[model samples]
Target: MAKVLSLILGGGKGTRLYPLTQSRSKPAVPFGGKFRLVDIPISNCINSGFRQIYILTQFNSASLHTHINTTYKFDNFSKGFIEILAAEQTFEHDSWYEGTADAVRKNFQHYASLEPDYYLILSGDQLYKMDLESFLDEHIKNGADVSIASTPVTRRAANDLGIVKIDETGKIIEFHEKPGPDKDISDLKIPPSQSDGSDKEYLASMGIYIFNASAMEEGLDNKDSDFGKQIIPSMISTKNVHAYTYKGYWEDIGKISDFFDATLNLATPVPQFNLYDEENPIYTKQRDLPPSKINSCTINSSLATEGSIITDSYISNSVIGIRTIIDSGATLDGVYCMGADRYETLAEKEENRRRGIPNIGIGSGSIIKGAIIDKDVRIGSACRIGVDKMDRKDGSYENYHIIDGIIVIPKKTVIPDGTII
Candidate 1:
């Protein structure tokens, strides 16, 4: 295997996921409860046997930096380590990263010094499992100056991405970045041999590229800062740019809706993307906590991480993070809850309220439905959450009932006991 320098782009602001991305960068946002968004790409690289990696980050990078420092570790004796290349001002440039290509261009000198054979560029916010070795092998075999990972998307969806027109031999001919509705796909005129009958046969770039070191250097030096807007197009006429087709489960969780959907999908019985693939294991910082204890709790197809205590709680179809506690008679359905930070706060409050009682007596008789509760929440007994029809029309009421449903409780809220609906 040749020496490959992998660059994972982790700088995007992720504006669409406003509140979630507000605190952390897009790549650092929590995913599947335990893993961060950046973990997918880094894990893919490690699984693909690439060790020399650099993550380029900029906006709201604190959490991202912490994650990288704690999660990724490489042997010092070996020539492999994951490093963060944060945006810095040099003599020539005082501005922040202007675009994707600009970010790589600024860091070009660093990778150049390493003298790697190939430069692998990846976006950190995508959810996919891939063996990059196969892509690199194909690039070498085709003698490609640049190899772009491409996937076929529906015509309706093609307008949102950079679409490529390739020949039978996979040579990319025409490149369109988010083309308009009227632009005929036939005008690009993909060769008859390469054409599939479906009208939605357009190939979309996965924003992943493998470039010959020299080719990347030259392109970055000669073109405008943006890759999608300029460098990629410049290469089409002069370079041997090929498209490597990918047919698998892949999603770009750039928007809040997409992120929500992706997280929920993991709870499916057989999810589209499997993180537990033995052949290509996605690595993360593993916690050595004990298994979740479910005592008289009804759990249905939910992902529960370590150190969780569910007592008489009905949890179903949700992702529960570590160290979460659900006291007796607490019911939850389709709730994504994290219990790390809130445990201490809730414990302190409970202790104060208990005054040295044997039982802390927090979070009892609480019913939660279709909600996302962050860590460290203490719900006192008889709190009706996520239930409909709290009281009967005749003025009679159940002990726990949710009204208007889908209530999201942020971390560290204290619900007092005997709170009726």
Candidate 2:
């Protein structure tokens, strides 16, 4: 196996995921409660036996920097290591990276110094498990100058991505960046005559590419900007560009809806993304905390990490991160709570607000449901939360009452004793 130089692009201004991306970069968004989004690709690289890696970042990358330093560490004796390349200004180039290709172009001299054989370019915001060793082996066997990982996508979804056309020999002949109407799909290469008459519109690039060192260098030098729009299309005519078929669970978390959908999917009974593969473990910073202590709680299909304490609460289908505390008489469904401090503030505010008697009364009859609570919440005894009128119609008032749809209780609000909220 050749020593591959991996460049993970982490510098996207995540405007779609506002508020969450407001504080950190998209790659640094908290995922599965505990891990960050960048952990997926970095861990994939480590598990795939490729240790020489560099992460490139631009916007609000402090959290991303801290995560990489705290989570991934390599021995000095080993050749395997990870480096973070933040944007720097030089006399010739004083501006931040404009596009994917420009980011690489700026770092070309740095990469050239390393003397690597192949360059593996990857996006940091995608979610999937890939063994690059297999992809690289296929690239070598095909004698391809550039090999891109591709998957079958529906025609409707193809418009969002750079669509490619490949011929019978598995050679990519044309590349279209977000095709427009009247663009001939037929001219877009398809395999030889198929058994079915249906249009064989298969194989869209996964935005993952393996480039020969020389090809990458040439493309970086020739193109002014934009890898997908300019450089890739230019190389298609001259180089042996090929598509490597990939069949796996992959997603591009580009927007808030996409991020939300991906997070919610992890709560399923049998999630599509498996993080428990011991052979290819998703490594993260290990917080030294005790296992979650659940006492008399009704929890169903939820993921609770270390240092969680759930007592007399009803929780279902949620991801609870480290050091979270769910008090007795609380009900939660479909929520993602990260960190303890934020949870505590919300709990206190709700406890005080529900009492109506201000600081002197307890919220004994409160109920809560379908809400995300952050850490360190101090709830008064007997608060009613998330309980519905229908639940009370049966003459059973054991559950807390729900106030409205999507109400979040900030952490650390105080409540008095013996009040029905």
Candidate 3:
């Protein structure tokens, strides 16, 4: 087996998924109820047998650090470790990480110390399942200096992605970044033999790269900061960059709308990104909670985690997280209720009742649709949470917000009774 060091890049400020990223990094943002975005990549690496991992982040990385420290623990006898490399002002560089490539370039010394045969670089916010052993094997078999995992995507989605064009021999020859609709990308489309069925599909980079140790050092020698924007494009003309075609479920949850849709997709009957694959289970910080109790609730097409209670409520097409409580007559549709961080005792519930405040979850008779009720939120009875007029624009309200027609109730918020968005 080749010695591979996995580097999971913690994304930028994540302004696109703001408010959710307000307190945590993009990778630290909670997803699928119990898991964070970082969990996806880390779990992938572990399942792929690459245990020596390093997560690199700079902005608001405390929570990300805590999660990594708490969740991924290995035995001392093994040579495997998962650690964080936060950006710092060192003697060599006084500034923060300017780009993705720069972040790795800055940490080259630590990476070199490992004496790795190959370096596997990945984005922390994507959801996918792939075997890196196969990826690495293909790279070695083809004598590739750099190998990228590319997936075939529709033309509409390809415009936002870094498109890669390969010859009949599967050798990448051209790469273009964020080609607009007006740009001619017909030349970038994949061959018919590689296409599963979609004629409009084009090969797009999955932001996953396997680089030979020396090639990585030489590629980062210049001022190029981003792999998509500079290094990969520049390397194609000089280095042995190849493409590995992958046709599987993959999504980059960068925007609020995309995040909302992707989260709900997991609850589907046949999810594109299966979270319940027994062979490759998605790992996360497990919480010891009791089983969920649904008392006469009309539930359909939903996934409620442990320690949740639904007392005669109506839930459809939603993912209710742990420690959630939905009172009688409450309706949840297309909701992602990331349940409370901790359960309030019976005494605390009594105190809230006397104070005329709802408990730590959705109250009775409330109607929530297309909304993301973040962790530890309290919604009063009869509250209507979806868009008041079905508008697809973004807006803000007190303690809540609407982005791309999806309501984002921030963490630890309290929505009063009969409140409509």
Q: Which candidate do you rate higher for lDDT, 2 or 3?
A: 3
Q: Write down the TM-score of every candidate.
A: 0.86, 0.82, 0.96
Q: lDDT by residue for model 2 over 1-421, one digit each (tens)?
A: 5979999999988876554565688898877878889988888888878899999999989989998988888998878888899999987788998988899888876778888899999988889999988999999999999998887666666667788888776778888887754555655644654213334365678888999999998878764677788888899999999988777888888765566557757878788898778998888888777878888978888888877777777778777777676665766677666645223356666775675433221123335445434333344566544444433221112222122233233333343343233
Among all candidates shown, the one with the greatest lDDT? 3
If both were scored by lDDT, which would come out higher, candidate 1 or candidate 2?
Answer: 1
CA lDDT, every prediction? 0.78, 0.73, 0.89
TM-score (C-alpha, index-matched) for candidate 3: 0.96
Task: Kindly report which residue pairs in candidate 3 clash with one another.
Answer: none
* lDDT order of candidates, top first: 3, 1, 2
Model 3 lDDT on a 0 to 1 scale: 0.89
Q: Which candidate, 1 or 2, has the higher TM-score?
A: 1
Write down the TM-score for model 1.
0.86
> Could you tell me the TM-score of candidate 2?
0.82
Candidate 1 — which residues are off by over 4 angstroms? 180-200, 345-347, 351-362, 374-421
